[model samples]
Target: MSMKDDLNKLNETVKQYRDELRVQMHLAQQDVRDEWDDLDEYWDKFRQKLDDIRHDADGVGQDTRETAYNLGEELKAGYERIRKRLK
Candidate 1:
């Protein structure tokens, strides 16, 4: 093919790749948002449990509190990671 024809082909290929990438990115964003929604639900449950424990301080065991704390930290880290990825 002539140089001009080759350049045109390359340009077309790049455009196709870019279009595909955009669609993939959009699908990925939706998946991430769905994951975040699920995490938010879990977070709400965790918060409710923490509040219950706080209200009944003496009834809650040390192990339970520690587990909750660790889980909360993990959730926070996961959330931060997702936020960073979105950015």
Candidate 2:
């Protein structure tokens, strides 16, 4: 597939993961939120990494988008676990 098609697929996959993350965040306990705040700086750094990686394919390199998307999935999984604990 072309780079544009690959990018489109990546975008859609990331969107789904992002949506799940939002759901998990919504269901997460206040205590969990507080705990997350303890690592707020870490998350901020991660966000910066992601931001830097997101750009035209040439500017960022081939794996940049994929790596960011994988990080997003990992974050979502963490949020999902916290949400489950809140249940």
Candidate 3:
């Protein structure tokens, strides 16, 4: 085949892969959105915990602080997972 014909064939293959990947990427995004929605409660609780701690830092017990810290860490990890999925 001529150089032009070979280039055309390669271009077609790339286009096919690009189209397939586009669909897969869209599905991946939906999965990520679902994961985020699942984390919504955790996010809300984490925010509320922080607000409580800020409002009553002096009155907050050690266990309460620890619980808030653990929840924050969990949220961070969950967000990191979503980030990696997007990548």
For candidate 3, write residues 2-82 as lDDT tens digits: 433433443344335334444545557677667767666776776676667668878877776666666666666666676
- In angstroms, give how far residue 64 of model 2 lies from its true place: 1.6
Ranking by TM-score: 3, 1, 2
Off by over 4 Å in 1: 1-28
Q: Assess every candidate by TM-score.
A: 0.59, 0.47, 0.64
Please report, in order, the local distance difference test score of every candidate based on alpha carbons: 0.56, 0.56, 0.60
TM-score of predicted structure 2: 0.47
Window of ten residues with lowest summed lDDT in model 1: 2-11
Better of 1 and 3 by TM-score: 3
The model with the greater lDDT, 2 or 3, is 3
Number of clashing residue pairs, candidate 3: 0
Q: What lDDT score goes with residue 27 in model 1? A: 47
Model 2 residue pairs with clashes: none
- How far out, in Å, is residue 27 in model 3? 8.5
> Cα deviation of 52 in candidate 1 (Å)?
1.6
